[model samples]
Target: MLTQDSMPPSAKAIETAEDLSSIAFGFMASKALFAGLHVDIFSALADGPKSAEELAGAADIPINRIVMLTTALASVGLLTIGDDKKVQNSPAAQSFLSKQTKYDFGDYLRYQIDQQMYPFLLQLNAVMKGDLSDDAIASYRHWMADEEQASVYSESQHAGSLGPGRTLARKVDLATASTLLDVGGGTGAMTISLCREYPNLQATIIDFPNVTEIGWRFISEADLVDRVRYIPGNAVEVQWPGNQDAILMSYLMSGVPGDNVEELVHKAFDALAPGGKLMVHDFMVEEDRRGPALAALWQLQHMAFTPDAHSLSVGWLTQTGKRIGFDVDQVDNLIPAMTKLVVFSKPS
Candidate 1:
């Protein structure tokens, strides 16, 4: 029944079974990559090309396991192997994965592995029970406070806001605006970008003390110290500075739990003088939440960390702004990549 010619069918079945089995163990591959990064494998490659044994010595990993680890990384296209078997970083690996590059994503990878992986692994439990575990919450709080984690968060925010910010800047005339208040402006990235684009604009960054310290350094480094002032305090509880012509709440309100979002928006409204503008940029999901892969992923990631946090729709924001005595308009799809921008104005 199973002759050599007939064996091809069974052989194919066997191969398929093996592939399925390997897929079941895919987590091992991720763990291997994480282990390599934790041991500074990419950093070792940054200096120059080296063999597996040499890399192990440089990274202080066990000599016997280095070949397997290097082979695993090469298989994943992170490393290139020469005819002589020397290992080197791939082009993409050098540009982004290496620690030396300014756009290096190693910190982001480290954050995911160290801060998020454990809690994310509990997604099933969270969905089944409709709540996050205590351990997950603790890990999330740690992530939010850590500078490395905050930097990753801030960088993602900056990248997303760039297109939208540029579009808004071009559309809205800001030559007359004197002062801007950026609530919860971590690292002053958005505010700095705004100030740099609009030379006449001056801004105040309001955030927690630690974040403000980092923001101050960023502002100083950007040579914007003269234009931007760092205000250290909770944006919600603190009395916002007056005489503001505009306010930017770029990616801030979602972090505030349920009812607090309304309070924060109202506070921003009150801070603005008549005819002043408030810009809120964030990921707003469709009411159905079935599409937009990135937004859906971010929603799950947000829930694992934040209490009473969900992506707000643009319609919801407009209604809330209207209730707070401001005329609201939705800046639909400012960025080709992003979903929504809700701009509210206080009547002069």
Candidate 2:
């Protein structure tokens, strides 16, 4: 039998078996949330609290099934059942999971995590074993080569990215910037946000052909078709449009190969105009390599799908930019605790 003395420090640190089991069964809670989203459980409760029968009627399912799902969701904090016997969405679920809400990112969870990342993680064991073949782990860019997959991924990401893009707009100043190059800009959501924030800003998003094709629709819908455009190609290989007053690369560095990161930074430096700025927003760890749990988890998940993805930290990025002769302007959080934005400037 395993005794206290035999337990590793990490295992011994856990105060209770319940805590350990909760961590082990964490996937069950996630699956409950996914199933709730899949069946529109949150949407059925969006207007107000509903009795189990009413939810069943709204979902076109039997009461027993709805009750089971709602019970699971309630257990996971996505839904709550009251003394009045009505089911209601949690504040977060009502805000971000209900299809009726403006900030709905239900599809990001449904499509990206459920359909893509979940399947990609099945090969994690092989990936961690130093197996780098396509069968073990394919590059994320390779997965996006399929037009259909690219469209679905880009569309979901666009829905999820717009809020962050707006946040980024509020944080960065581009008052005098007339031209921007959004490297690997997915669906032009960030570009649209920046253009809306800075009226004089005209932007270009360079991404894969399939992704850019879908991005045009979002750009058009934002009425930014004239000000924001797409250049479809590999970001690392393409001849970037030069003389850009600013370059925004959000969530791009964490996906590319480790060897290619410095090269891309140098390229971004070359592509900027004199006195231009480069903004890199990504999942970066702390200098000590300790836990900022979500950022570390995101980097691990990215590596499961990417054969050569690099681990990054704010310190390394600051050092790389400084070595490339760019001046460090600022470093701040982008997505609350999950991401950081590092801004560097080219000399005038």
Candidate 3:
């Protein structure tokens, strides 16, 4: 028998085993949450409170599973159920979990399920074998090509625009600025945001041809066609239509090889006009590479998916920027707690 002073060996071992088992089964909770979002359960509850039966009817989920799903989500703090057994969206869930909200992460969850989870699980063997299979390549190609539908891809690109677009408009002295180039600007989100923010800023986005088509559509939809230009070409191979006042390379470099990244940075340096600025926005690992868990995990994911890809520390990036003839300054964090922006300026 286990006592306060000493536990039996069997009891201790069983407790240890149970702890390990729970750790291993952690993904089950994630799958449950993903399934809930995939079915728009949170959105259904956004309008009003409902019981499990009503929620099942509204969300088209099986009646039997409704209670289990809602109870699980409630346990996870995503939903709330009163003593009366009425379930409603929690504050966090209402803000971001519901599809009806602008900040809804439902699409992002769906993208993770459809694009990443299964393939990653299935290709664990190939990944470990260090083989870049055809299927893997095809999946990557499809991911890049389907930005319009892939919420994570679109969200990553939009992340760059969300901060810099607002910051540049408010902080940067744009009246003197004439031309801006958005390198690897996916869907022209940054350009559109910038153009809308700064009337005088003429922006051009360079990306793959297929990606540029989506950018063009966004530009047209935002009525920014007059201010934004689309250049459909490879960012590395093309001569970066030089003499621009500023260059924005948002979330671009981390996906390419380190050498390619260095080369591209040099290319941007050569392309900038006198006194032009280059803005680089991407995940930056801490110098120690121990904390900031997201960056560490992202580095592994990038390596698994892209060729010779890895995130660089901000210290390394600043050093490289200085070496390439740019006066560098670390900009404020865009997403507050996530990533930092590095701003480099060419001499006048």
Candidate 4:
């Protein structure tokens, strides 16, 4: 009865299976992209089109390797091969992947996803076991403890957060709020964006000492040295500034252990003034917790590196806020790819 040929799958089922297989092979596509970034192939083609041989020469790789990689690149729409087989960037690649572009995020890919998170998959089983000593493996906590590692992590993460920061600035208004606190705001990218939008807003960012220096660098780069300040300590234990009208916890909850979330939420509520607003920006998914393939996949990917790195849903957040005596509002598609911003207000 269960023989393979005995029960033929429907067309829809067949298509679903094909899609699932594509998901299974998704790592190959990511690896191919990583390989291209590794060799700075997109930057090599930034000025104009080039033949495989030309790319090989510019990139200092063999022609055969260039041809192979370019073939894969074209498959993913990163590069386009002309009638004469000259390779050039697709619009998407040109804008975000090329090093010369203003909006280039190639470094984020190179350092964060390709370097840091990708290899964590290798220890998926070990991470699931949850037996590794804090110092034994490169857990999120372990890496954050290292100043050098924190620098790389902060810079790489900052690159990816720039676009979202601008979007979030547009979505959340801080015109009436003078003083704001940003907890776990590494490099203060979001704070910089918000401060630029609301010139009257003065903000303080709290993060590890390892990240505070870089956070100050970004704040200075935004020319908001007077408006933005830094607090170096553990977010949960830090003495929160009282009577704050606004507080931001961007990606903080998702990065910490799952069991810590409720306590963190309570801490935030207690820290805020009665009329203050608490904003949470992090990876989230639909109520049913399905789809948004990247967010879903990342929760599992994060499991390999952190104790509880799963995305939190807006509905869950809303109910959580209500349970803690606050009203909840949300703006979806803040990042579109992986982040949603939820706002909580403490009733006056």
Q: Kindly indicate the candidate among 1 and 2 with the higher lDDT.
A: 2
lDDT of 3 at 235: 81
Model 2 score (lDDT):
0.87
Assess each prediction's global lDDT (C-alpha) against the native.
Answer: 0.70, 0.87, 0.72, 0.82
Model 3, 14-111: lDDT tens digits are: 36777898768867777777878778888999898999989889888898899989888888788899999999999988987787876665665666
lDDT tens digits, residue span 211-286, model 1: 6765676788889988999787777778899868999886666666566788888888888989898888766655
Clashing residue pair totals per candidate (backbone < 3 A): 0, 0, 0, 0
Error of 4 at 151 (Å): 1.4
Go through the candidates in order and give the C-alpha RMSD of each one to the true structure: 10.0, 5.9, 8.2, 6.4
Q: Give the better candidate number (3 or 4) by lDDT.
A: 4
Q: What is the TM-score of each candidate against the true structure?
A: 0.71, 0.94, 0.83, 0.91
The 10 consecutive residues of candidate 4 with the worst lDDT sum are 1-10
* Preferred candidate (TM-score higher): 2 or 4: 2
- Weakest 10 consecutive residues, lDDT, candidate 2? 1-10
Q: Give candidate 4's whole-model lDDT.
A: 0.82
